[model samples]
Target: MLIKTIFAGFGGQGVLSMGYVLAYAAMVEGLQVTYLPSYGAEVRGGTANCTVAISNEEIASPIASAPDNVVVMNNPSLEKFQHQILTGGVMFINTNLVESRPVRGDIVLYEIPCNDLAHDLGSDQSANMVMLGGFIEKTGLVKMESVRSAIGDVFKEKKKAKEMNLKALDVGFDYMRNNGGKA
Candidate 1:
C-alpha cells in the first residue's frame, strides 16, 4: 500500500511537524517513508508545507505532484493546494482558519476546526496534532498507538508537551470518528 500526503499552512502552524511525525510513525511500523519540507524565507508567518509518502514497498520518489491526501491549515494553503489532490483523494481542511472551501467534487473533504479543538485542549499549538489524529483515524495508515509513541519520541524532553499533544491527538481522532466529514 502507498499513500502520499501534503500538510500545508503558515510556518508556525506545525505543518512540518505533522509530516515528520507521520513519517516517523510509518517508519516505526516498518514502512518505507519519505518526508520533504519547504517553507518561505520568513518562516513563522510565511507559507510552509511538507510532503510525506509512506509505502509498504520501495518508493520511487518523495515528491507528489498529485497527493492522495492534503491537509490544509490555513486559507492560503487551501487555495494553493486544493487543486493538487488527485481525484477520489481526501482533503482535510481546518475550518477554523480557512474561510474558502474547495470547489472540487471528485475528492473527499473533511472539515475540521483544528485550532478551535486545540484551543479547547488548552493550546492552539497542538492544532497540527489534532489534524494528524483525524487524518490517521480516517486513513488508518498507521496505528494510533504508533503515533502516540512517535509523539513521545518527538517530544522526549518535555513531558507536559508530550501529554498535551497526545491528548490533542486523541481529541482529533475521536472528533473524526464521531463527526466524520462534519466539523
Candidate 2:
C-alpha cells in the first residue's frame, strides 16, 4: 500500500523529526521510504513541513502533492495543508492549537489536545509525541511498537527526552483508543 504523510507546523514543533521517525520506521519495516523537508526563513516563527512516502513497492513520488495523511500541530499548518489531504486520508490536528473545522470531509479526522495533554503529563514539550500518537492510531501507518522503536532511534542521544517521548506517544494512543477519533 502507498502511505504518504506530511508533518507541518511551526519550526520548533519537531515536524522534521517527526517525518524522520516515520520514514525510519517504514525503512525498518523493510518498506520503501523517502523524506523531504522545507522550512521557512524565520526559524521558530516560520513554518516547517516535511513529507514522507512509504510503500511496499517502489515509491513513485516523495513530494506528497496530495498527502494520504497530515499531522498538523498548529492552526496555520491546518489552514495551509488541510486542502491537500486526499480523500479517505487521515488528518490529525492538535486541538490545543487548532480550533477550526477540517477543510475536507472526504478524509478522516483526529483531534488531539497535545499541549494540554503534555502539560498534564508534566511538560509542554511532549506535544509532538502526542500528535505522533494520534497520527499512528488514526492512520495505522505502522505499528505502535515500530513507532516506539523509531522514537528510540530518533532520540538516541537525548536520554532525558526518551521516557517523556514514549509516555507522550502512549498517551496519544490511549486517548485515541478511548475517544475513537471523535472531537
Candidate 3:
C-alpha cells in the first residue's frame, strides 16, 4: 500500500517534526519512505509543510501532486491545501486553529481540536502529536509502537518533552477511536 500525506502548518508548530517522525517510523517498520520539507523565509510563525510518501513497494517519485491524506494545522494551511486532496482522500483539520472546513464531499474529513486537546494535556506544543495520532489511527499506516519508538528517537535531545508528546499522541489516537474520524 502506498500512502502519500502532506502535513502543513506555520513554523514552530511541529509540522516538520511530525513528518520526520512518521518517515522515521515508516523506515523502522521496513517500509519505503520519502520526505520533502518546505518552509517560508521566516522560521517561526511562517508557513511550513512536509510531504511524506510511505509504501510497501519501491517509490519512483518523492513528490506528491495530489496527496492521499492531508493534516492541516492552521487556517492558512487549510486554505492552501484543502483543494489539493484527491477524491475519496482523508483530511484531518486542527479545529482549534483552523475555522474553515473542507468543501469537498468525496473526501473524509476529521476535525480534531489538536491545540485544545494538547492544552488539556498540559502542553500546547504537542498539538501536532495529537493530529498525528488521529492520522495514524485513521490511516492505520504506522503502528503505535513504531510511532512511540520514533517519538523517543525524534525527541531524544529534549527528554523532558517526550512524555507529554507521547501522551498527546495517545490522546489523539484515543479521540479518533472514540469520536470516529468522519466529517
Candidate 4:
C-alpha cells in the first residue's frame, strides 16, 4: 500500500526531520520512499512543511495535495493544512501547542500532548518526535527497529546531537507503547 504523509509547522519544530525520519524508516522497511521539503521562503514567516511518500512501488510524485496522514505542530500549521487532508485520513496535532479543534470529524484526530511529553522526557524541543512516535505507532507504516536506526542514521555524523535525538525517539516510542495513542 502507498502512504502519503505531510508534516507542517513553524521553524525549529523539527518539521523537516519528521518527514526525513519517516522516509528513512520506510526505506529501512525495504519500501520505495520520497521525501520533499519546502523551506527557505516558507521559513521566512516561520512556516516549515514537508511531504513524505512511501509505497511498495515507485512513487511518481513527491508532492501530496491531499495526504493520507498529516502531522501538525502548531496552531497555524494545523489551521492551514487541516483541510488539505483527505476524508478518513489520520491527523496528529500537537495538543500542547494547538488547542483548536480540527475541521474534519470523519478523519481520525490524535490530539497529542507532544510538548508536555517531550518536556517530561527532558527536552521541550523533542515534541515533534513525540508526536511522530504516536502517529507511527498508530499507523504501523514503519517498524520500530527501522525508526530507531533512522534516528541514528540522521544524527550519527553530528556526534553531539545523536544522544539527544535517539533519546527523544525512544521517549516518543515508549509513550506510545505505554499510552496506546490516547491522551
Best by the lDDT measure: 1
Give stretches of model 2 more than 4 Å off. Answer: none
- Whole-model lDDT values for every prediction: 0.93, 0.86, 0.92, 0.83
Error of 3 at 107 (Å): 0.6
Preferred candidate (lDDT higher): 1 or 3: 1
- In model 2, state the lDDT of residue 48: 96
Question: Can you give the TM-score per candidate against the true fold?
Answer: 0.97, 0.95, 0.97, 0.91
Residue-level lDDT tens digits of model 1 in 69-90: 9999999998999889999999
Per-residue C-alpha lDDT of model 2 across residues 2-55, encoded as one tens digit per residue: 888899999888788878887888888888999999999977869999999999
Ranking by lDDT: 1, 3, 2, 4
- Which portions of model 3 miss their true places by more than 4 Å? none
| Candidate 3: Cα lDDT at 60 | 88
lDDT of 3 at 4: 96
Better of 2 and 3 by lDDT: 3
List all candidate RMSDs to the true structure: 1.0, 1.2, 1.0, 1.8
Pull out the clashing pairs in model 1: none
Candidate 4 off by > 4 Å: 40-45
Q: Which of 2 and 4 is the better model by TM-score? A: 2
